[model samples]
Target: MDVKETAAYLNVSVSWLYKNAVQSGLVIYRFGTGVNSKIRFNFSEVEAWVKQQRVMGG
Candidate 1:
């Protein structure tokens, strides 16, 4: 899904998703280039990562 869609689905701000998820390499994907660059995420991946984070007390 798109960045906005992912952020909405995760109930988080777009900026938060970009910073914490994308930049941190926690739960995001990048495609295209420059202004065309897109951000997407897999819901399952996000869920699993969250679960791992919880297990790790992060």
Candidate 2:
């Protein structure tokens, strides 16, 4: 999904997704070139990551 869609899905700010999710090595597909590059995410991968981040019972 696009930045807006991703942010809404994650319930986070767009900048947070860029800084944390994208910058921290999460996979992002880039379209176009140079300054026009666009980023997209795989929802399944994102959902898996979210599941991985979940804390188990204490």
For candidate 2, report its TM-score: 0.83
lDDT of 1 by residue, 1-58 (tens): 7878877877889888877885555655778889988878887887776667555435
lDDT of 2 at 53: 73
Q: What tens-digit string does per-residue lDDT give for candidate 2 at 1-58?
A: 8988988988999999888886655678889999989999988888887777779998
Q: What's the lDDT of the predicted structure labeled candidate 2? A: 0.84
Clashes (N, CA, C under 3 Å) per candidate:
0, 0
Compute the lDDT of residue 11 as modeled in candidate 2. Answer: 90
What lDDT score belongs to each candidate, Candidate 1 first? 0.75, 0.84
Q: How do the predictions measure up, each by TM-score?
A: 0.68, 0.83
Error of 1 at 19 (Å): 1.7
Candidate 2 weakest ten by summed lDDT = 18-27
Give the winner by lDDT. Answer: 2
